[model samples]
Target: GSLEHTAVLALVLAMALTAAAPALCFAALAVAAGGLGTAVFCPGERRSGAAVFTAGCALGALAAPNLTGVLTLGLAAGAGLLGFLLCPEQALRAVFPPPATPVGTQSLTSAARKLSGVADTLSDIAETVNAVCSCQMPPRGESYDYVVEFCAQHLCQNCARRNTCWVQGYSTAMDGLYALRGALEHNGRVELEDLPGQLSTCVHPADLCATVSHGYRLWCSRRQTRARAELLRTALTEQYSAMATALAQMAARLGRAGLPDPRREARTTQLFASLGLEPLECTVLTDLAGRVTAAVTLPRTSFTPGECRALAEEMGRICRRDFDPPEVTNCRTVTMLHFGERPLYRAVFGLASRPAPPETVSGDACRQFCDSAGRAQMLLCDGMGTGKPAAVDGQMAAKLTAQLLQAGFAAESAARLVNVALGLKNAGQESGATLDLLTLDLYTGRAGLFKAGAAPSFLCRAGVVRTLDGASLPMGVLPTVTGRSTALTLDVGDTVMMVSDGALCDGSAWLCDQLTLSTRLGQSPQQTAEAVAASAVRRSGARQDDITVAIVRLERQKS
Candidate 1:
């Protein structure tokens, strides 16, 4: 069909050229047009069209008189029309196909730019908050001033000798009040004898002592409250700052990510068209690390499992990189499919947990999952003591940590933020949990262990067991807690085992032996975890604390 169109166009142009340049040979022009059309159209089907074009050229060259030439021209034109009508659909496609320009690239760049702007907004808010909080904080030596103000308001305001004690004898009254600081702080009260003679000679010495003592108590309570508030403010400030920095870095990385590959985009578009799927938008973003993420938006429709797999395979081929199956989401007007870079290695997790004696729920919580960044994370938290109360604390900590990590936060930031939340939950009561996290970068096999007052984790590699132990305070005990981080490399067949303190209460030797024996015997991670947890409970006899064991083993993904 395209060849026929080309012939019609070429012949009309030739006629125009002949009229414009009468000295030019008309037959030569026709021959050149045929060769040009052959080059422009597909090769296999060129024979019929080229021959018809050549006949026209030859007949024109004869310059025969009258009807003879006219008949020859009519025959040539009929032959060309026949060739055009017989052209294949495939050949037509070769002549005019999908454009190579990358679709949705501008939209992707705009999204990244918006993210950068959001980061800037967050930074501005954090800076503004930090400035406000800093200004509200009282100076270190102003506690005494608060005590004096309290005494003046609650005691001297009603005293008959108020002017004599405060205004006329201002210096004496101030000195007497300042001197009571040590007595109130150390002994919780001040005696009449503790006051200066000038103030002791007042009409109501006993009342003065009682009122001043009460004010001192109130001042101490106020100071404690302020201290807690200050700690909370500091933690929140740091969290906001950290969040802004992380978001900004992510935005910067994506904002300047390399241009989309035209070849890949064109091939992908063609494949979708072939599959009868009309995509509204399709974009492939490659980061500085060469990691690729593809997004395809289509009219809201469901996809069969096979169709999804087919799309993934076709996309992988187009990009020359393996892609995980697209995660599908349906918005109000469109369906979105997001494909992330698949990791080389996969992890299998196994967990075994049990409550302490006489309790139905365990005080330990564990989670195993993969983050959007392709990092496999396993979390274990041990609460303060065994019971439902402890279980609640442990579960809360683990849940919050998992959510933050999944949201793309750094491990340390998430832990610190959780710590601040727990520390401020109950004003006067103490509540805390130990955090033990194992993060594995599935793409690189690099592993990190982060611990906060939890038991040591054991790593079994090639029949040898290595201990990952660190001494750290539990969260909620302080204003902010920093988890201990240890990094190492892992590979296929290497297993990492984590447990609550109850598992290692009797010491780590038994668990180490169990892990090493299990590895040598080639037991599955689930079996090993169950075996270790049961043995630890048996060793505890009465089971004074909850027992939890989780193991993660790296394995090569089967293609």
Candidate 2:
């Protein structure tokens, strides 16, 4: 009796210990068993075994205490293990020997390949679905129902494997379409008329459905959004291309007529009209048969003899004329005069009268110097912000400064007047304007620079560059802001560049490089300015910003 009881207790203890083993040990054993089963069975048989195991476990767990009773009846498991151990070792070895042909491993390789392929397909589908969700298309009433149907049909066709992925994708797409339809229908009635456009715009419906099916089969799968963005980018590029083509054609058609002088009155009007720009107090001049000409007078600040010659050559090219002789014909004459107690620089050229005969300087000194100097006065004011308010403040400062300067007031006095005007306009808002006032005096070969909260003007001379800083606050904000005037003496080969902060900030280095290159190339002031402006624009890639520049050169007359 004692021996039997001892044997029973040992067996019960062993069974209980095995049943209560740590989760990891149980999991390992289960994995080993599964691997053995997989090795013995084909794919279909393995799947069947997996299904039976899942169903049995579910049923046993649901049966509660009955599972314990079934597990306690371990005689069958013990007998099976005993039989497995007692089986002939030679026969077992023969049954489990490595395959002679590597082709026998095709089952696993084929399954792995299919699994990877399905995973990739599912990933693509998920990306398509996500893209559709993110799409910002306008709602299309009952057209949304059609979209759902379209997606469902594609999903069914692509994911005919009847996997959970297909069902989930179909359901999700349908739900989305229903929501969209509801929103659209709430606003108005849905119609089949809108279905075509919706269908056309729906991207990769079939692929999305296929992905859903594949994802359902895989243990883990993730959904693709870059495709939609790429499509948008492509569309934008196409639109730009079309616009550029049309514009190029138009420009070519306009260029077919005879070249108009950029410097003569009628030509200036025609040129501006052709370019769709506003008319200014400028003229365009052309040579014989209107082939070559100057459209705009070179600003005194950017004028240079080389630029003049280049302009003339450009004109000659258009006119097919011979104006190059004048370049060599007039390179030795020099002239000098005095203005307001300062000796003025001068360069003479045969193209125009050889230096105006010295006459008594009359009229308002500032106004006469500005008007008769063959130079334009420009007052640039940057307000505190963008939009209407800033524009208004900036315009006020510019207007007042121009008015005072044109009325013969000195630069300092003009700046003071602008300051006063701004203060009156925006006394309480703390709004102000920064000023960059430049007076190009071609007659005196000087540029009067006045600034109030603006960067110093840049002067390029003899291949050296220097900045002239101004010490003053912007206008309007302060009750009274004093400004000082600085005179920039010009030479035949010197250039004075004045620009607003907007232009300078956009491409200061490129502007400097362009200036140096233009000077080296011996370009006229106008050419240098235009080239610099164009280069700056190109460097900025057409980032729109306010741009302004003023250039002046003096050319000696030939002996």
Candidate 3:
């Protein structure tokens, strides 16, 4: 058979198949290219794997669209084939893939499991965060089962400064455990430097005491222990005056009883009793689609399982206040999904912006994140201008970036993923957004800020403000990007503020002054956001750009 004649006939056939099955046609063309390359590169070698990979890439290109996507896929297919011819192992590795950047644990298995284990529970954080639902009770009798496990857990135990030192201890312990396990299992595949620095999360005021308090509250209700719990509660409050003081001292001084110390349990019992707060453990989850599926574990109530079903439904609504989902369902049992209040912190966001025409939507968008590992992230995007066109660019940047972060991707990886996605989305069109991302460790009040062509963000701690400015160009405008990232420390009563150019028109110095004043005045995060937006609007006198301000405060909780 003459290959030239066959190539011509195959091209004609592919052209015909494009109308009925474009994806298949693409696959065939990619296979043809890869097969030819393999045959020429390594005459006696088998390259079936490379051919399959090429076909898969072609199918992926169909889903990705754009000339950039198709070209990238074509190049990859060619490279895969060539690589298979030269080194089959490397080619196979590319198709099979390996574990992503490790989280610093020792066991390859544990780290891998941490990355891909609990497949049904959470495959991607971005998808899960989006699924944060405000699901009202579904039609009664409709039910779904979720196997939830606490993917990560940390406890700063036995600390004179439990609240203060516990965070670091937990971080060290988790990191070391992983490092040791990884050494034993993966033989140097995982790196501690690659592991996440720490764990963080946010909890409600009622859940302040969490595990310790829940046990105490339950213990107090018994008629025999009511008098003792009440006395203990009063005494515990006397030890700490304010919530801030309580948080610090509790971390430093609190301990539960075990061995020789008979008073250990009693000590916790009294402390939790004084808090007068209830404990409800809930975490955000995602279904197959990127919708929020909040997993909650109800405490043991005297009510029977049948009776608790209705009660659980009612309580479910209250738990989902942070996530706005359309419907909520319940598993009519004492379900214990993996959840803990480690490294707790509360996150809040606010925006104030006007469109260029005042008819179209503003260009800036803010995304609040509850990523895996109890981490909270605030991602802000501002497009080129203040109109619908700008809004689209900004929304894409914010959303895609957020999803990547939620999916357990690091900031750098997330940025790259967003870049590729945007490059494919707006091939010939010019679209871009200034993205500002800040991740706060709830446990330690440490913040990491990453920027891509964004304005400066502020950090307000103890009434003192610090400014962090951006250092990169906007995303979507570039084929590849690695924005600036820096670590900043926060202590008790710290607030991180982000604003668009419109908000800064009043001047960064002036904005800093205002934030410091707000902190001194003890303004809440929402109130501060409103005040900042109001000031920006006042400065513009109604003629303004799309201005957005986000405030995230780390509060030390009191029992």
RMSD of each: 8.6, 41.3, 34.1
**Which candidate has the top score in lDDT?**
1
TM-score of each: 0.69, 0.33, 0.43
Model 1, position 324, has a per-residue lDDT of: 75
Candidate 3 overall lDDT versus native: 0.53
C-alpha lDDT of residue 550 in model 1: 98
* Each model's lDDT: 0.74, 0.45, 0.53
Candidate 2: worst 10 consecutive residues by lDDT? Answer: 348-357
Any runs in candidate 2 off by more than 4 Å, and if so which?
1-369, 372-376, 440-447, 538-544, 555-559
Could you give candidate 2's per-residue lDDT for residues 310-422 as a string of tens digits?
Answer: 54554345344533312111112311110111113433211000101121211000111233224546555667654556666766566555554543445665565455445
Candidate 1 whole-model C-alpha lDDT, 0 to 1 = 0.74
Cα error of candidate 1 at position 411, Å: 3.0
Q: What's model 2's TM-score?
A: 0.33
Clash count per candidate = 0, 28, 40
Q: Deviation in angstroms for 447 in model 3?
A: 1.7
For 1-559, candidate 3 gives per-residue lDDT tens digits of 1233335554665567576676555555655554444334432335564555465556546654468758866786687568656875545433332222222221222123223322322234224223421221111110001000011222223324455433546555344334333332343222333333332232222222243233322322343244434433543343223223323432332121011211221222222223332223323333232333333333433335454344334333433322321122223433332322324455555555555445468899898866544567998889887678788778877876776565345666566555544443444257778878888776566778899888999988677788888678877675666489989876767788888888876678889998999889988888888898888877876567887888887766442
Question: Would you give me the overall lDDT of model 2?
Answer: 0.45
Specify the highest-TM-score model's number: 1
